[model samples]
Target chain A: MKFTCDTKELSRACNTVSRAAATKASIPALEGIKIDIKGKEVRLCGYNLELGITTMLESKGDSEEDGSVVLDAKMLCNIVKKLPNALTTIQADKKSTVTIKSGDSEFQLVYIPADKFPELPKIDEKSAISIPQAVFKEMIQQTIFAVADDAAKPIYTGALFKVEDGGLTMVGVDGYRLAKCHESIDYHGQPFDCVVPKKALLEISSLLDESGDKAVDISIGLRHAAFMIGNYEIFTRLLEGEFLDYEGAIPKSHATEIKVDVRTLVESVNRVALVVSEHLRSPIKMHVGNGQIGLSCATSIGAASDTLDANISGDDLLIGFNHKYLSDALRNAGCDEVRLQLNGPLSPMVVLPNSGDSFVFLVLPVRLKAG
Target chain B: MKFTCDTKELSRACNTVSRAAATKASIPALEGIKIDIKGKEVRLCGYNLELGITTMLESKGDSEEDGSVVLDAKMLCNIVKKLPNALTTIQADKKSTVTIKSGDSEFQLVYIPADKFPELPKIDEKSAISIPQAVFKEMIQQTIFAVADDAAKPIYTGALFKVEDGGLTMVGVDGYRLAKCHESIDYHGQPFDCVVPKKALLEISSLLDESGDKAVDISIGLRHAAFMIGNYEIFTRLLEGEFLDYEGAIPKSHATEIKVDVRTLVESVNRVALVVSEHLRSPIKMHVGNGQIGLSCATSIGAASDTLDANISGDDLLIGFNHKYLSDALRNAGCDEVRLQLNGPLSPMVVLPNSGDSFVFLVLPVRLKAG
Candidate 1:
């Protein structure tokens, strides 16, 4: 394609599409970003089968010849990034090679034939539902970390999204711990439930931060989901499986309760875990009694213990848990003080922010072998 | 040992020794830091055979007894790093296990026997020479980058130091590029020529900063070199081989000369090199003539060209060079404008700072094959 565009606009479009371009894809054309110019706008698209990103820029008081070429994203970016800030003009010769010219410099880069590019599934923009960008990003941060990375359990590989008449709840569980959060939204009575892959959510979160004063338009299709933020649109295949019933796994009662300073508890547990064996099961015991809570990790090689004075009540008891699972939950809770409810040493413990139970973190305690 | 010391002092000592302790060493003892207590001071030592560091801290107004033990550097550092600001006490029991008590936390860590710790070599203080910390650090930086990394050339793996009555000069070469710098020292009549290992010079440079108030004492023994800076001492073995005669490699005359702004030249060539084939014998060709320099790189697939104005005084000439070697020298030349001296397309070109030849960088040009 022959076009003269602002360097900033070109650079931003290249960066957004390059994220979906796989560095080591078996298909050679997948490594190239497809560029197409038709009416008054130019569009760039990149796809790796699993994920795709497409972005467009409209001409400002200008018009260019309608043409298309698929240039290597990596080499084009390197050249544009190194050139001094200025307007850049790119043109395709009769031989089908692209030339980028700026100041006294000219670069000829080979391009893959645009016809070889895979066809991207068309997304209907009219069926989209818009949500506040801030709320959407926060929900992903709150629940995405708990998603299991192992693909053996396909359902747990993605975050479960449940949307009803009033609100939306997102839940993620990795067998050891579970994180769940809910956000109220203004929507019609369109009810839906789907599991969105963690990879798609992660990429969406990275680009959402820059969408200030703008909303994220999300559309759910029969088999694919699309998120449109700013000039960029990201699409991915919807996960096909049933998620676990996380509500049935959360504990309801407790035998001992303690309220602790969130920062103090997280730092103490992380320090003690440094000496814990990585191969063996990680079990850190917490003794709640009187007016204090004691955190302890005992191993065959060594032991570490830290005591924090807190407001603890109920029966005196000791509970063991996976150190990482508890820390992740406490950090994500986002509260000054957190109240931990323990039923017994063998049951899962419920960790709740002092303010409310809207965000709950549940950790399955490790069973300490009887001496 | 039972002693309470300032947290900052203990942390600094631990960090200095931990640098020498490699986590992937075959010998387990080498992974631990040896802590010895005697008189009013506590000394910590860590080594990995190739290099070693020792740091000492004297006890302030604290209650304690005397003992010796070796603790895992990585583990101890992790615990001490997380502790809040306060003095910490380390106590050893009859069972020989150590307890670190900081604030409300206590960590019991297993230690290797002190007798198994390797002993650091002793260098005579009489064979020492004192130099300004800033000057010594600068000398190492000017030459260390040119040292060859290939194990095949044992002599080129170190910086050659030529010390005489007038002053001292250091030179290093990696077959393609050479860097040499000279500094005035306080050495007397006796002259000494030795090759200091590149690893040792790098450590010494990082340890010594631009503080004219302090001095770095270098003691050259028969087998090892020791550098004592403040309360820390570092030891490294010297390379046992003769360095190449660098003087013969430097050209006595030139056929063409050009003076250009260092920043502009480096940036332009760097951009053009992006399109050049990496690790290839012929990377880029420079055509220098009347007041303008043109750089071009062409592969079987594509080509890029750029031109920049320069102050030229000689006839037109063309030279081929590995773009990376030229870029490295230009980046580290530390000058606003550089004067390039060239003999021919086959001879090495010398790049020097515009003012004087205090620092010299020479790059051997690549020989182009006939078309």
Candidate 2:
């Protein structure tokens, strides 16, 4: 295989695909990136059992023969990144030795036959939906943090994506918190629901463009899902299990509501949480009354108290919460002002936009010991 | 004790002293910063058994009483860093509760009485010598990287500071490489030699001013060394042992010499070293002939080669070296062009400035296996 391309372009493509490469596996070929050269096109692919990423780039140098080889993903990426920013040529001989040269530097590495690489699962494109890259990225970022990392319940490790008519809603729920975001897309297919692994969504989010001018096509199959980016394609196995009924779990009624600036409340909570050490798991208390929220936390080492102004319209209430969960929700609210709904000290607090239903965040309060 | 000071100034002082605070110690007071409130001057001190740092800042608010307390260094630094950027007041009540307030945020932390904090050693200033902060800082940086991290010989872990005839020479030597830096200062004190711990020199270097106008007063006592910079004072125990005879170890003549651009040689060595993995322990070989140096490295995984232009004189030589040692010496040369002097394959390669003796870096060659 003989191909020449811009050193930076090759480096970027290697980085993108290597994210899916297995670091340690029984099969050695799973840790390699397969490079296939044909005419003027070169395709690079990296795949573990659960996820695969592939990208194609045009070569500038002419090739006398077409061939394929698998090289160690990490070494190839590092070598390319360090090479001088110039045109680089890579040629593989029949002896299973690959020579890479750029400027005055050259590297020769051993490679494995591409036939040893595992084949990626075929993606059915019957159920495909296109959404703007910016919107999709936002949807993933707002909900992915709530996914449970524990493997005890495998279903909770993935986010649920539900599409109906022209609207798509993504929900992530651990035991203590739930985050949901909805966006409208131009879709005219049967409604479907699928669970995407958190790892896949995170990788997809990083590859998405935030300019809002480009769109990504997503296809959901029976057992696999594929996301088609501009010049790259990411494929992953769909999670198989029953997901939480997030719609029914959300509280619909509230006894008290307060509107507060998101930044102000986030800062206050962060200061109060400083006293709550990891070894001593203490909850931050919030007293909402007289148009202000008094936040306080006392631990063995120290005690902190902060107050923030808010617009209140109902009975005063007192609540306790795990500061991290509350902080995450407020930061992800993505609005200037947020409305917080509380039923009582034991009920889950709901965070909503001041006017719209674009996003919803619910955090369960911690039970505080009586003073 | 009560005082008000600029939040930023107090935070900076805390960070400076906290570097000497013990992370985990049997004496809890050693992990805390002692704050002494007297009139309008507030002093903060952090001392482990081996090293201590103290700095003073001016307070704006009047105090009703003067006292001292020791607070947890990490917690105080974090709280001060997060507090609003305004005048911050700290007050300690008779109950041993310290209250810190800034804007609307308040933190009450339990403190230990200052009497429990260790006392720092007093240094006699009769043998004090002054040097420009920028010059001393450079001298430390040029040699510190060569200090041996292995604690087999405690003396080798510290740099030897030799002062005679208004000249200060700092030398750091491990078994394989040696780095020496010297500067001319305006001092007439008695000649003295002492070894300062690497940890202390690093902290002192960071606190030194980069601008050449400022000067730091350094006093060397029988067992302790002190550095006074602006409003901060740093004290450290002097390491006691016989040091390497660095001057006698350096060779006076060479059979071959070459002049090359520092940056070019550094980049070539870095690229060649990429193939030398940690587990493989391969040495990079330099073949000097035909007015260019050919660098190459081959390991079990792969091979890399690069060629750089140089001005060669005398006999052509082939030398092998550990890439890291070579890279460090070349980077610390601190010059646009460096002269390399070589005697033979087994002899140490000395790197020096093109003109003067401001710095000298010597790296021993690694013996190569027969081809």
Candidate 3:
């Protein structure tokens, strides 16, 4: 088997698909990226059992015969990136070795048989709904960070996607902090919903080109989902678990509220965190006074305190929370000012963007010990 | 300490001396930087027992001080770096806490007793000799990379600073690679010789100013060496052991010589090393053919090979050596063209700059198994 293609195209395609390649594969062949050359097109496939990524590239003006080979993804990437030439010629020898030559440098790499490569899963695309890439990317970025990283809790490890008469809502909670983003998509054509695993969503998000003008088409089924963008297609196995009713869990109203600058709050938390003990859950206490904001953290190792002038008008209240949650929420809130809704001490608080209704963040307050 | 200074100046000073601050100190007081605010000057000192760093800021310009305090170096650096203004006031309260205020942000840091801070050792100014900072910095950079990081052998962790007969030579070896540099320096009417620890030389190298006109006055005694660069003084304890006689270790002549481009050799080694096994030292076989260079690394996992065109006159020879050493020599050899002087397999090869003098690098070839 013999094939030739542009060095840049091959490198870019392999890199994009190889993100799903298993680092420690139970099946040795799964560690490689499968390459198939048919007529004038080259298809690359990589998978990790749970998810599969496949990308195709056509010859730029020139056509070649059909061929197939499975090359080590890492070695191929390193070699292609370093070779200095526009056109790279790759020819397979005996189906056991692949020869690559660019300019004056040549390399012969061993290849595993293409028969051992895993088969790409099939998805029913009849009920697909097209969505703008920017809308989906923003929703994922705004909510994915709140997903629980632990696999012991299967439901929390995946973002709950609910589609109903109102809109589509994405909700993630790790028990301490929760992030929710709601968007109205063109879903009337075919009502669909699935709880996509955080890892799968991350892979799909990385595959989208933020600068491209193309729209992404997403299709969901009973136990599977497919995302299509340009010539790349991703298939993920939907999680099989019951999602929490996040709307009922969130607080409906608050008695006291304080508006604070998002940037100033994030910076204050970062500074106070420097002196806070790393092992203990970093609980920063917020004391809201007449026209003032006070932040403090005390641990066995050390203590730090800072105050920021603000236009706050309410009864003085004190609350303790994980500094990291507050920092993360403010950093990704995409708002100039954030409203801190307080129910009472020991109760959960809601932080919302002052000017937008699309995103809302919630944090569970930690109860301080009796003085 | 009670003083107000420009945040940028204090930040730069803290950054420069904080490298010597101990992260995990047996003596708790040593973890803090000693700040003495006298009538007209404020002195900051950080020590980890073996080395001490002292920097001074006089009150003649903008800083006004009249007291002293010792604060944790790590915490002070973090607070100063995060504060959001140019002028921050530091004051010692009656409760022994230092208050740092900038704009509306305030941080109260606990301070250790100033009396517990270690005292800086005094150096005899009569024995100090001045050397241009550029020459000193360059000599250290060219030799320190080869020093043995292994602390089991005490002497190997230091670079031999030999001063005799109006010349200074710095030699370092890690058993596999040797870097030696020599330059003539006036001894200021007195001769001295000593071997400074590798860590100390690296620290001094970083402290040297980029301005070419400035010079560092250095003094060497039986147990301590001090470097005075402007208002900063660094004192390091000497390693009490005999250094290796590198003069006898470097071979005098060679059986084959070849000249090659430094950049080309470095790039090829990096590419071929991708397949070299990690546990087994990365040994790349070099075959100097007629006007061509062939490099290959074969392992049980995989094999990678590349050949580049070079101007060569030596007879056909194959030598195996650690690719890292070759890459390092080529990267730091300061010359565009390097002439490799090889003795034979299992013997060390000398990498000399084409300009003929000032520096030399030696790399030992890996003993290959019989084919």
Best by DockQ: 2
Q: Which tens-of-lDDT digit does each residue in A30-131 have in candidate 1?
A: 887888888668888888787899999765425476778888878777787877547777788767689988788888888888887888876543345677
Give a tens-digit lDDT track for model 1, residues B1-371.
Answer: 77777878888889888878767867677898888777567888988776888998876636667888888888888888887648888887767699988888888888888877777776644355678888888778778878997667787898887877767788989988999888777878568877778887877787897866588988887667888988889987778886878888888888888999988988888878877655433468999986899998887556788999999987789899888888788887767899999998988989888978877889999887777
Residues A90-124, candidate 2, lDDT per residue (tens digit)? 99989979999998999999998999999889977
Q: What are the candidates' individual DockQ scores? A: 0.76, 0.82, 0.54
For B276-320, candidate 2 gives per-residue lDDT tens digits of 787987999999999999999999889999998999998999999
Tens-digit lDDT track of model 3 for A159-242? 888775546788888888889988886665545557888988998888777775678887787777888988888888888877
Report the error of model 3 at residue B91, Å.
2.9
| Chain B structural similarity as TM-score, candidate 1 | 0.93
How high is the TM-score of chain A in each model? Answer: 0.93, 0.98, 0.93
Fnat score for model 1 = 0.88
Which portions of model 3 show Cα errors greater than 4 Å? Answer: A59-65, A164-166, A280-282, A313-316, B58-67, B93-96, B124-127, B188-191, B280-282
Off by over 4 Å in 2: none
lDDT of each: 0.82, 0.91, 0.80
Q: Indicate the residue-level lDDT of A278 in model 3.
A: 62
